[model samples]
Target: MTTRTILAAAALALVPALASAECGWEKRINANTCGEGQTFDTATGTCVDQSTS
Candidate 1:
């Protein structure tokens, strides 16, 4: 196959893997529930301890 065609196929193969990868914290809004001693940070969309954050 041509180089361009091979590159296109390789890129397509990476699409699924990239899609499944967790790029960042899961998106949540106003659902501030967190485990004991942890507080949900709205800016980062993650749970952090009160002392640390």
Candidate 2:
């Protein structure tokens, strides 16, 4: 491919990295203590889990 074509392709490839998408997570724990399996909730900011106790 030509130099310009290659450069353009490279720039387009970086579009996804610049996206707002992020590895979201949530804390699923009780107010007293965090006792649960933390998981990724993309919906929120952090991972969530089932609180116990």
Candidate 3:
């Protein structure tokens, strides 16, 4: 009925969505697509250069 009441309702509606958020790297990483001299790094979720002599 009042401004404060409406805002409270809106905030409560958003609580569930905020709580269900996914915290991590991208959904999936296709390591097979890495470059010839590179490899996928799980820790950083990226392709990195492979060490060689």
Candidate 4:
């Protein structure tokens, strides 16, 4: 494959990992105290009610 093609493939492979990393704080926060009826919101970096979220 061409260098550009290879680089594109590598970047695609990294997308999911990068996405998960972006939301890693959600996992950590939810693990601590998200509580029922609430979930971690990566955008706000805090727990929010499921209904509003």
Candidate 5:
């Protein structure tokens, strides 16, 4: 294949990957309902004290 054709194919292949890629940070608009001064811990899947965190 020609150099230009190879480059075009490579660019086309990357189009879907770039389009499907998730960009930007996720924001939590609402606060966690795990009581006062407590946050939800993903590791243990429970509310943990803020002091320890």
Candidate 6:
């Protein structure tokens, strides 16, 4: 393949790989919830306290 053709194909392949990730959260809430210092959990699908662990 020509050099230009190879470069074009490479750029096209990277377009989708660098695209933004979706919501990333496992769930969503309806009403205004989460107390003064809490947040939603993305893995277990619940709202709970924030922890670095």
Best by TM-score: 4
**Candidate 3 residue-wise lDDT, 1-51, digit = tens:** 999999999999999877777544346665887889999998998889998
Estimate the TM-score for candidate 2.
0.36
Model 4 TM-score on a 0 to 1 scale: 0.46
Least well predicted 10-residue stretch by lDDT in candidate 2: 23-32
Instruction: Assess candidate 6 and give its TM-score to the true structure.
Output: 0.40
Give the Cα RMSD of candidate 4.
7.9
Model 2 lDDT on a 0 to 1 scale: 0.62
Clashing pairs in 5: none
The models' CA-based lDDT, in order, is 0.78, 0.62, 0.84, 0.80, 0.73, 0.69
Instruction: Report the lDDT of model 1 for residue 30.
Output: 43
Task: Determine which window of 10 residues in candidate 4 has minimal summed lDDT.
Answer: 23-32
TM-score of each: 0.44, 0.36, 0.42, 0.46, 0.42, 0.40
- Residue-level lDDT tens digits of model 4 in 1-53: 89999999999999999997887564455435888888788788789878862
Greater TM-score among 1 and 2 belongs to 1
Residue runs of model 3 more than 4 Å from their true location after superposition:
1-27
**Candidate 1 TM-score, C-alpha based:** 0.44
Ranking by lDDT: 3, 4, 1, 5, 6, 2
Q: For candidate 4, what is the lDDT?
A: 0.80
In terms of lDDT, the poorest run of 10 residues in model 6 is 22-31
Q: Estimate, for each residue in 1-53, the C-alpha lDDT of model 5 and write its tens digit.
A: 99999999999999988776644344332336588887788776677778952
Give the Cα error of residue 9 in candidate 5, in Å.
0.2
Give all candidate RMSDs, comma-separated: 6.3, 8.0, 4.8, 7.9, 6.9, 8.1
Candidate 1 lDDT, 1-53, residue by residue in tens: 89999999999999988887765557554445787787778788778777953
User: Residue 19 in model 1: shift from native, Å?
Assistant: 1.2
